[model samples]
Target: MATSTQSPLAQHWGYYLNGVEQAFNWPKTFILFYSSSTVQKSLFKSLFLNGVVFFGGLLILETFYNGPEHRILGCSYANITGFPMYIALLGINGKFFTPIAEKAFEKQAKAHPRTTPGSTNIVQSMASMIYTTIFYINCGIFAAVLRSLIPHAGPFLSFFMNCAIMAYYAFEYKWLYMGWTLEHRLTYLEEHWAYFLGFGTPITALTFFLTTLHSGAIFGILYPFYVIMATMATPKPATPYGQPLTSGKGTPTDLSAPNKVPIFFGVRKMNDLVISLAKMMGGVQVDSIVAEKQKMMKMD
Candidate 1:
């Protein structure tokens, strides 16, 4: 009957604080976080490959298709500008570092028997990937449309909006890796929007401003750092508002319960799948499931 008593700041802000600490203690945090040589090797290789691809692809495009004007990075200034790259930027993070993070997470899980199981199976990971890709693509399009609607405002508002979106995208891998459902993820984002925005603001500035100054290489390197930090933060769950996640085997101790609404009329979950199908077949009485649920609740 006891409840979590930790303050909201302590619950959700631990990793964020650790990140700030790590910024000050770069060498120590790097050594501690990447103690394993295998992980270090994998991350280095991924970063190298991604950098080559990103820079090489740009070189090819600039040389062959758009000429010098299309070059964004390693140039004096940007002559080509568009919003499509924003969506591609999200995909790049997932394409390169997600596997490495997953590997590290699996290793962590195996080494610590007490660790609660995360949702890292291929099916779940794939589903999360699909869902996130669709979500970000929609967000990118929405940002582009919004920018068009208010061109007089310049990229100021668009940058802020995109930064918030990208911030969620940054932590999303960790959230899904930790087995958070869509409802839980959305709720956490809503409740801690400011914290998340602050967490992601640096990366947003890098992607938007630094890249404009031909500093994509810097952005490329810093990208993996954020992903690594996010991976480290994944297991430590946070409450919706207050209290850090408990050190046990289950979801975070948020005050809100999972939604109980039926996806369709009279269907709450898999238990009612068959009954709902039966009603669609017209072989069972309609509203029977609801009535039965009401009776069960009354009995309880």
Candidate 2:
């Protein structure tokens, strides 16, 4: 936590700096990632398949086949092959990543032993995981649209949005294991927005200038390290300092404190809209099927 003597601005920026420092604390990341056999295996598979095989193949094609016709072929190859390959890697790597995250969380739990409040039902847990995954993907898409649509400040806004999203992704595995709801995670992130922004900066900066496929490949390679860092990190929220009484009237106020930024507010709204539409469509399909069954019963 930030000291009371520091102004709110200083505390906020202090947390941001702390987050940045934590992100690049690679000695700890290396120790964690290499110490566990499971993490090692996952890193190997992710590095080989996503990094060496997929991205390496593209790099080879681009290098060897640089003609206009070859460019067209490369584009077609990426669309037809690389896209599906990436999706498959995500699914495969998800299985590997989950165990890595669980082990990391369990290791931390042994030392900290804090009670995490969340639903224990397997079905509900699965549903929440699925919902959260969709919400994240939706948030990414919305951020991209914002980047393309708005002018002047669009890129900067999108950049910060991506930073927040990346931070969320890094911490998500830990949060999920702790049984935190999506709402709780988002709220915590917003309240300590600066820290996460800084934490997410390194990853975002590394990938930001690259081409889409290149960025995706780099992100896949680096994400596990960030996940480990997030597990080890202790996020400090910005502290509010008391303001002197104005006009010597009433009580001292905390108006000087930095306000919580609702970073995920837009994404939450978007996710809700999408979920509502999906449910409505599903209900319609069910009703249609029931009506068809009723007609068959009448005929019988």
Candidate 3:
């Protein structure tokens, strides 16, 4: 009697979560969130803080010595199709999305007095940029050392392996339930899935190669991943580790039982949002246009 609902979304999320748990199993897939936390927490903090210094170091060199004149927000090729788009997608969040996060940080700290929340936007952004830099640098050295050790490695082979690993994780997030559906846990996994999609595109490969080999071509590629991340991100609900929003209509199993927490985005933004009749998709493109930019940037 309980088999009626939307096609894919109809199924309750409890089962969905089972899939998530299996997917994040570290040994099964080396690409995972825990790998990010392998370092001592204090050392991790120091690493990102140092990453901030490293970013500054590069910027300093560019600004004074080499001309780090390009804006992180600007693009060399401004489309979602190219290899560069991948890096822009990932990197743009630090430049553009950090503000929304910072606001949340301030509010969250005040809301939960005793609870120890994570670090600040400044730190998180530093972490992303810093870690990204580190990954690329490491990748470069590995490429160089391995080339002499195993010169048989080629672009096709490297790309194939990267794609294999990345595709597995990406699909796992889309279809599998990798964790408990508790809002906190769900939210955590959502970020892990959405951001830091490792080695997904050629630009990603380039960044890694450039960092280790000092290849300028590889260096220019990091921007698009950041851009795509900011532009294409599904405005994930603020809820953490959400499985199914418990239903509270009539039956005892109603999830609307608790004072329902608000959706991440407020009505102000979604209000009167336009949708296309054909696509059934409304709202503007994820690309940061003039209007979205002004609003997000708070610059009139």
Minimal lDDT window, size 10, model 3: 173-182
Model 2 lDDT tens row, 32-91: 677788888877887787789888877876677655666454465554566777777776
How far residue 198's Cα lies from its native spot in candidate 3, in Å, is 8.6
Runs with alpha carbons beyond 4 Å of true place in candidate 2: 1-4, 71-74, 115-130, 242-257, 283-300
- 1-300 in candidate 3: lDDT tens per residue? 342222222222322333333333334122221332322232333333323433434445444653234434453221212334334434543333233223323333454554333334133233233332433344344334444555567554444333223323233222212222123332333333322223244333544344322232233223222222222222232223244333445434333221122222222122213211312543343232323323322311
lDDT of 2: 0.73
- Cα lDDT, model 3, residue 62: 49
Report the number of the highest-TM-score candidate.
2
Tens digit of lDDT per residue, candidate 1, span 1-300?
134554344444554444344323345327534676655765676566446655555555545767455355743222342223433554465555666566556655665555554577534334334333444455656556556677778477566566556556556666666766554655565455445545665667667654432345446556656655554443233333433335555534544432221111111233244445646776333455445433322311
| Worst 10 contiguous positions by lDDT, candidate 1 | 258-267
Per TM-score, what order, best first? 2, 1, 3
Ranking according to lDDT, highest score first: 2, 1, 3
> lDDT of each prediction vs. the true structure?
0.50, 0.73, 0.32
How many residue pairs clash per model? 3, 0, 41
lDDT of 2 at 80: 55
